[model samples]
Target: MSLRMATDADVPAIAALMRASVRAIFPRFYDAEQTAGAEIHIAHLDRAMVDDGTYYVHEDGGEVVACGGWSRRARLYTGSGDRDDDARLLDPATEPARVRAMFVRGDHTRRGLGRAILEASERAAGAEGFTRLVLMATLPGVPLYTAFGFAEVRRVDVTLPDGIVLAGVEMERPVTAGRTRCPPGRP
Candidate 1:
């Protein structure tokens, strides 16, 4: 029941956790294909790790039971709708960050790990010198973001590389000094 940074050895378990989180969180809001593709996001995580991005995992008895991560320099993509200037990455005037993705295994749900992950992400981002954090919220992730002080900036359609499309929301939170609000966005 302690959280630590993710190591390369944790990749496979992280992938399984991501898959489980997606399945558990999306049953009420997404089609099978859309929900299924959520797990594929895990494949991109190696780059995040290599970039020195912060990835936290909750381990119990040497096993990763829950996890989350965030990228100080996150990915931005052109998609199916308008973008808020605030949602834009690489803004010179703001120290921006993206909570690219985050998930906890299904069996570990309702035990405070998700909240722990979120707060850890906020701390990591804030400590890394970011003033604001952004994330694309999925149907099941909206409430969690809101609970972490992330306000909805806009809802848009994202076109994945494989031409898969999904409805998602852009949310932002101003990282105040000394506050750890939620898990990683990439979280």
Candidate 2:
């Protein structure tokens, strides 16, 4: 497996992977309408992350298997209605870097892809002087974020454009360099 920075050319494949992941994994935690809303609103490509050089894509055997990123911009997550300051830059000293869109292929879970991506994101954000990382994680993603040291700040219900409410967790973690190491015998 190889983890590398994502480029504009990878958007189509990344978007497809995001949708597939949501469709495959969301059913366990959400109803059909919520799942569909998530697929439409949550499973999207944030081109700004790519342009800002904060997104990453992981490939296994030459196929993209996972994608995620961190951003220093004001946007907390995608698919939420944009705020007036959404495009503004954040101060790393005061604001935690936003851990943006993360999606692993439906067939690629339990392989450490998510962990690897988080590791890269933490290191990069830390290097840029960010002291913490924050994310609004879907229910399916909360376990992974928790395992990676993120703690829940609150539960959120995002109302999609179609008026469906998708539950999510707001999570945060400190950006500790080299802190992504797994425990003994763990993958």
Candidate 3:
């Protein structure tokens, strides 16, 4: 497997990977209603992440198995279906860089792909002079984030288009230029 920066050409495969990953993994943490709502709300590949050059994809045999990225933008996460004007530049001096969309193919879980992406994101964000990172993590993603040194700040209820609320966690972690690190395995 190899890791590389994402591009517009990778969007279609990225979207399919996102949908498959979410569908297979979310059901473990979410109810049927919540999973259906989240399927519509969370499974999208934001082109801005690629444009910002912060997104990455892990490919094996020319197929994308995992993808994720960080952002220096205003939006914590994308709104359902429609892409909005949420790409406002962030002030790294005052705001934590956003660790945006993160998803791995179901078969690729527990193989350290998520950790690799998270580390790459932290390093990129730190290189931009950001000392902190924050993300709205899906319930199934909490364990990974927590193990990576992120602290839960609060519980978030994401209201979906169909009036179903999906639960998420607001997590943050301080990341210095060379201080962000995590031990391997499901700790």
Candidate 4:
């Protein structure tokens, strides 16, 4: 498999992959109702992420299998079906870079794809002088972020368009000189 920065042309494939991945993987942690309820709100690909060059996609056999990225912008996650001040530039001196939109193909789980993207984002953000990284972790993404040294700061209840609220965790980890320590055996 190969990992590369995502381009605008990759958005459609990325969105499909995100939806497939979430539908297949989230059921393990969420019920069918909750899974279906939150799918649309959770699976969209924000074109701005690609435009900013902070998003990435993993390819295997010429197929995009996993996708994710980080951002200097203020948006923590996309497709929440709400309006917020997500376009503001973060103060890297005081705020952590936002580690947004991460997903892997369900059949491709347990491999290092997610870890690879996470590390790439951390390195990219660190290169931009961001000393820390933060993201809103879906129930299924918690283990991956935690394995990457992110600690849960709080639980956030996201209300979807139809009023179905899904639980998420806000997580953060410090970045030091373009390096981070992943938990042993996580990848």
Residue 146, model 3: lDDT of: 89
Pull out the clashing pairs in model 3: none
Off by over 4 Å in 2: 181-187
Residues 14-53, candidate 1, lDDT per residue (tens digit)?
7766677777876678787776665554223444542474
Q: Which stretches of candidate 4 lie over 4 Å from their true place?
A: 184-187
Question: Any runs in candidate 1 off by more than 4 Å, and if so which?
Answer: 41-46, 50-53, 76-93, 180-187
Better of 2 and 3 by TM-score: 2
lDDT of 1 at 123: 77
Error of 4 at 135 (Å): 0.7
Q: CA shift at 177, candidate 2, in angstroms?
A: 2.5
Give per-residue lDDT, candidate 4, residue 160: 74
Overall lDDT per candidate, in order of appearance: 0.68, 0.91, 0.87, 0.87
User: How does candidate 1 score on lDDT?
Assistant: 0.68
Residue range 53-163, candidate 3, lDDT tens digits: 999999989999999989998888864434454778889889999998899999999988998899999999999998899999999899989888899999988877778
RMSD of 1: 5.7
lDDT of 2 at 71: 95
Ranked by TM-score from best down, the candidates are 2, 4, 3, 1
The candidate scoring highest on lDDT is 2
Question: In model 3, which regions exceed 4 Å deviation?
Answer: 80-85, 183-187
TM-score of 4: 0.94
